[model samples]
Target: MPITTNGIHHEERGSGDRTIVLLPGFGCSIACWAEIAPLLDGYRTILMDLPGHAGSVGAHADGDLPTLAETVYDACREIGLTRFIVAGLSLGGAISMRIALDHPDEVEAVLGIMPWNAGGTSAGDPVIEGFNAAYGDIETITAGITSISNDPTKTTDLLHTMPTVTEKMWRGWLGGGAFTSMADKLPGLRVPAFYLVGGKDFVVNQAKQIDDVRSIPGGRLVLHADLGHLACYEEPELVAREMLNFLDTHAIAPA
Candidate 1:
C-alpha cells in the first residue's frame, strides 16, 4: 500500500490489464473490500481510501460530492489509471456514479452497491438522517452498523474504524451534497451500469434503487432478498459471483 503525496492512500492488487477501482463506503477504508478483491482474480483492483478516512489526510467537510469525486479521480490519474471500471458501496457508490457520469470515456462501466441515491432525492433517507441526527454518537453508529451487517467479525471491524471518522467528514456528508440526487442524469448515462442492493436493506431504499438503475441506459439491478446494507462483507462469495457474472455478461473480459 502506498500513500500519494497528496495524501490519498491507494493500493493495486491482483493481475490483468483491465482494472477495477474499488471505493469503500462512508467511514470505511480500503480494507472494506479486502475479501472481495481477491475473489475477482481475473481483473486488477485498485483500492482507495477517501479523504479523512484511514490513511488519507484531507478535510472532507470543505468539499461537496463533486469535489470529493474529483479528488478520487485526480488521485487515480496520479496513479496513471486511465480507463477502468469504477465500483463502490454506499457513499462510494454515489461517487462512482458521479465519476462515471462526468468521465464516461475513462469509466468503462460502473457498479454501485446500495448507492446513496437509492434512497430518493427528497429530504434524505431515514438511515442517513438518523446518522446526521446522531452525529458523532458512538452508540448510534454502532447500533446502525450492527443492524445492517450480517457478520459479527465484519461488524467488529467496522466498529474499530469508527474512531478515525472526523466530525468534519460527518458534517461534509450533510452539507456537502453527499446524498444529493443524480436521478435526472442517470437517464443519460453512457456506460453500462449495474446496481446491487439487499431487499432487507435498512439504509438505502431497495425499490427506489431498482427504479434508479432502470433509468440508466443498459442498467442492471441485482436484488438479494436476504442481504442487508453490507452485503459484500456479509457474503463476499455471493457478491463476487454476481459481480463476475455481470462482467461476463457484458463481455468485459480480463486483459
Candidate 2:
C-alpha cells in the first residue's frame, strides 16, 4: 500500500520505467481503471483516489479545479513522482490538464477521456441536472447508468461503489469540477495533449470537445463513434490501445 497525502490515496503498479498517473472521474474510485490498468503493461501506473471519493477523505466546501489540481500534484510529489504523464476521465481529465497547465515542467503529457472542460458540461447543463436529480436515489441512478452503458456488470460495479461517496464530497466535486471551465487556459498549454471523446456521450458535447482540443497547439483528438461517457469502462482494451499508441507516437518516455 502507498501513502495517503491530503486525504488522497494512491498506489503504484507495473514495473516499467515510464510512469503515468491515473485519475478517475467524479463519484468514482480508482476502481474505475480496473479493466484498463492491466492493459498498461509497460508503464508504471499510479492509480489515485481523489478527495471525497472512495478511499479518500472529505473535500473542501469550495474545492474548485485549481485547488484540486494543487492537492493532486502535491500528493504525487509526496510519492516522489517528479516527472510523469497525467491522464484522467471526465473530471479527472480536467485536473490532468490543470496539472499540465500549472506545472508545465513537471508534466510530460496529458491524456483526457471526455474531459469536462473547454465549455463542456457544467452545473446547469442538462446532463448535470440529471445527475443532480438522481444523486441520492439509487433507482434513478441505476436507470441513468442503464441508459448510458451497454454492459450490466460494469454498471453493477459502479453502483456498488457509489454508496461510498458522501453528499458533501459529491457537491464539492460538482462545484470544483463539474461547474468549472478551463477554456481560457488551454490555448497556452505547453505540453503534448491527447483527448478521447465518445460520440454517443450524453454527458459531454462531442463537437465542443473536438473544438476545445483542437485549440491547443499540440492537442490530438480521437472520436469513438459508438461509445458513450463510460467508454473506458465499456471498452478498456480499445482505450488502452489508443493511449499507448499516443504515448509511443509522441515518444513520451519516463524522465
Query: For residues 1-255, what per-residue lDDT tens digits would candidate 1 score against the true structure?
Result: 587767788988899778999988887777778899999968999999877778774534343677778888888898999989999988889889989989988998899887776334456557667766766678988887787777656657677675576677767775456556778888989888998888777777666788888798889988888877887678888878887888878737436
Error of 2 at 205 (Å): 1.0
Candidates' RMSD to native = 2.1, 2.0
In Å, residue 15's CA in model 2 sits off its true spot by 1.4
Per-residue alpha-carbon lDDT of candidate 2 for residues 1-255, written as tens digits (9 for 90 to 100): 555546778877786777899998866788778788889878889999876677765434234778888888998898889889999988889889899999999898999987776664644776676766676899887777777676766756668656566677666665445666778888999999999888787777777788788789978998888877877788899889889989999746645
Which lDDT value does model 2 have at 86? 95
Candidate 2 CA-lDDT value: 0.79
For residue 180, model 2's alpha carbon misses the true position, in angstroms, by 1.5
Off by over 4 Å in 2: 58-63, 120-123
